[model samples]
Target: METSRKPVLYSYFRSSCSWRVRIALALKGVAYDQAPVNLVKDGGQQLSSEFQSVNPMQQVPALKIDGITLSQSLAIIEYLEETRPDPRILPQDPKKRAQVRMISDHIASGIQPLQNLAVLQQMGEKKMEWAQRCISRGFKALEQTLQETAGRYCVGDEVSMADLCLVPQVYNAERYKVDLAPYPTIRRINKALLELEEFKTSHPSRQPDTPPELKA
Candidate 1:
């Protein structure tokens, strides 16, 4: 919990889920080591024996701290919140917190799970058009919701967990070649989020695993 030691994060540069955790860690001012797990190289380095020991699920964005390891970005973020409350990302009011969580879930549950790289790969093996259609549909719903709730940030002026969720999903949508112009809300929030130092630094292009050409 203390900032004295650095936490180890198993992450990939291009992974939106890992980028979410990276952004949260940076926002919390939590020092961490970027243990790059090249998702595309070496037949998916996350599945390697060495990495699997850290995460049996062989997933990127795992965390190791004080001999305790954790899986899943959202869960890891909640742990960080519980252990370190300063500069809180969630709202103090229960209703506001629920709203924040709702927006986070809108992306986490509603969109991310469907368009994850692995899932998209599986879909590609079946049909690429189907993959694009599903991702577009999810984005359409997200665009509508963000238009209704967005202010300076996703839910308001303060950077809640929702902003963290929104930024990376937008990046993923772009990667899938999804036209973002239709989602004016998403484009607006994405522009604002990109201006922040934390979000800018935690961007996938800024990570070590990101290709030189992709770096912004």
Candidate 2:
């Protein structure tokens, strides 16, 4: 049960940032070890000193690989993109790559940060309403962005980092009761992405740490 050949990933089933990295690793055919950090237990395992040593930010997706630890979902992904160039996650064209990053940033920074667990926990009773409004506004902008940049996937027919980022945000939106009916392009792309083996396997429901009651 103990093997160090594969890189170790510190993750949580429901953390969308962790989900992004999971999807990327599966898509690239990289073998990794999953070390689940239960975010809701003991007020959050991520906040513990042990995990903080791995990621000062105490985030769920702290990857330990290449003899070092890396944190921040996007940064860990970019490192993978750089080191493992085959089956690329980014496009060859500079403009297209920029477009992909633009949409990715829109979700990662614009939407995700606003509705994260800490923020929602702070909002308490108002969290549901606040998160719904935040998701609606962000999705409105994202739908417009996708209308221009998407073609089957967020950037083009090929799956990019944008699509990886998109699916989990949409999942989070659903959790907050944010309707997806208005975002036709997002829904279309998400449906297609869900069908992929990589995306399907990387879903929260399929993760090892998913509770028996929650697993698909």
lDDT value, candidate 1, whole model: 0.82
| Model 2 CA lDDT for position 125 | 97
Give the whole-model CA lDDT for all candidates, comma-separated: 0.82, 0.92
Residues forming the 10-long window of minimal summed lDDT in candidate 2: 1-10
Clashing pairs in 1: none
lDDT string for model 2 (43-123, tens) is 999999998988899897988888888988888888889988779999999999999898889999999999999899999
lDDT of 2 at 168: 96
Give TM per candidate: 0.92, 0.97
Per lDDT, the best of the predicted structures is 2
RMSD of each: 1.8, 2.4
Per-residue lDDT tens digits of candidate 1, residues 105-186?
8888887887766776777565456556766887788777767677888777788888888899888777767777777887
